[model samples]
Target: MNTDVDRVVAHLDPGPGPGMTEGAHALMREIITAEPAPAPRPARRRRPVLRLALPGVALATAAFVALSWLLPTGPGFGPGPAAALDIREENGYYVVEVKDLYAGPDRYQEQLRGVGLDVTLRLTPSTPSMVGSIFPTSPTDHRYLDEIKTIDQPGACEKMGGCPIGVKVPVGFQGPAEITLGREAAPGEEYANVTSFDALGEPMHCVAFRGRTVAEVRELLAQRGLAVHEFRDTNPYIDEEAASRTSVPDSWYVNGGYLRAPGKANLNVSEQPEESDAGGLRNCAAPQGS
Candidate 1:
């Protein structure tokens, strides 16, 4: 019931994995001597970080993706969904995995393996080569999705050199453009992700979903007093062709100061927009994390 106890329990009782058996007293000896339990944290304090590089099959897929995909310009490339963004079973609970599509060889190489799970991202045979997304035939909408900047106002410390004059420039601030996650992953009940400009203070919005099934995902939203709707990448950013295939028109959550496709934040990757906003989030504009 407490944080310290929970983490301790995690390692002490990592759960009986599939097909695990004590080969002999030999195996048990190593397992028992593996490591000591860590000191428990107070029930009220925040713990340290969990992830820098994504974990699980995403890492392996990303390795191949990074080596094979480089800089993708559109969808249907980069291992063609090997490191799909899905909510899947991991150590008995559902966790998200992002295949290392763009990770460098030195990065994300070993940080993604889940302790007690043997997971891997699988791609359908029909998918194209990783290079296809990087060098799209018909220009794509994912060119500049992941850029962040921090700037200071130019005139904050400037004077008119002792002259009686005033300046007319504004101060500088740090702002991260909102990211569009829904451009790739759509929301579903079995697994759903929500993103907006306000997420942890940044101008990014997106949707990532992976669940037991589509219908099951819908039910979770209902229980939360939220309606399950469709997702549409019709904002200015999406390409015309791709937009046509993934629009959500009947849900809520878009185009406020926060969400680009406002309303339920339920844009389906293959539907139409329920409402529209000019200068709202667009799909074809750029892709975050390149």
Candidate 2:
């Protein structure tokens, strides 16, 4: 990572940072699979004094498992001061939520539809260069979102603690990030809360709260019975690195050029790309806080 940074800095003459760029941390890895320690040696022990306790403990374990299942189907999709937003479920599918930022709503709507999600848009009143956002393009889609934002943004929504459509700039946005709505929301259909959509978009951070929800956007893990992890307190998964605005390379640091001599070598064992991945040319996924 430092080597990459150095290359960028050399390309740009004036350093973007006084040197804090070097102070930046590495991105967290996809997941934390701590290296397993050696198996513990079995210690000699007498059998339990009472056999009756075995059945009771088993029953308790079963009940604990059952109760966990009855919990909400989605991840922690409620209001938070989370550094990152997450919508996860044990079964599959999730929602990503963010607040306060500029965007081309229409453009983003089309983009999602192109990826095949039956979109539920909630547009804001802000107008772009008059060209409109492009995430989705269906008229039905536009109509759907227009109605939702119009309704949710004005009136107070139940449980979410304010209007159904919360933005980063909105006040009183500290409650359920996602309030279950209708029958769909009954089992799990819900949205998440907002504090800021900034840090969630760091590069290498798979769970980001950028233009879309990361949890809902992933393909089925299909590992049935697996528990979903939505929140962790600072156990940095390092491969998931994010560059900061202060980290952005200055003209004196970042440089670009056409590929050299370009003699491509191909033996043909190309790996399949992820379908739901957010591959794009844009500013940092999340900008640093103001």
Candidate 3:
């Protein structure tokens, strides 16, 4: 009997961690076959004891401890600050909400990228009624934005705070989109805000010339004797990476371009390949403290 038990014990050779080799299973089989039947003997009182395979139990406990150490903890176990914008799909369009009042435009654009749309939001001062308006064209374009016309204000939600902005973008829209919001004017001001088109006449729309570079647009405007002032590219995603105004001319940047509208010479150029996603080009006198 002792020899049979020794044979079964010899077959066991546990590997590292929880991985048991085929030899371990064979050992278990041998243990079962080598066990001797209890012989008839007088029953003797003995203290109750719990019997368990210490090696297998210890291995399982060690594996559990190792997994616990590897598991992540804390707030969702990701990187970066909490996103200030919330994006959701409603009907057929994507609804983007601004949860933070001072959230940077570039961050908003970054958050939108995950939504599969190249939409952006900028808080530009506008008339009270026209506040929270959508501008699909460059600042030079006088064509009215019809996209905002389609959106209806929704009932206030619990999450919406002071800077509640809901922008509806089409599902398949891949290009850039900008939504301009009207900023509240400071004290001693009668009205809330102003826009580029508030007082100035409708500027020339440049949808026909989308691919032209800033230098090309500048040359075109110069040929027409239109003075383009403060030419700057407007792409929220690349805004931070843009060269300094003193370092490089606006023509150097490859995205949408904006010019200070001197007098009535209407000239606005967007770098976006599509005319639908362009704006921020203009020379408007912004109200102070707005």
* Cα-based lDDT for every prediction: 0.22, 0.18, 0.32
Global lDDT of model 2:
0.18
Q: For model 2, how does the per-residue alpha-carbon lDDT over 201-253 read when each residue is reduced to its tens digit?
A: 11112222222222321111112112222211111332222211111111111
Model 3 per-residue lDDT tens digits across residues 116-173: 6654454432222223323232222322234532332345321100112333556676
Collision pairs in model 3 = 138-279, 256-271
Best of the candidates, lDDT: 3
- Give the distance in Å from residue 154's predicted Cα in candidate 2 to where it truly belongs: 18
lDDT per residue (tens digit) for residues 106-135 in model 1: 222122132222222221100010001110
Off by over 4 Å in 2: 1-93, 120-122, 126-162, 165-290
lDDT ranking, best first: 3, 1, 2
Provide C-alpha RMSD values for all models, in order. Answer: 23.6, 25.6, 34.1
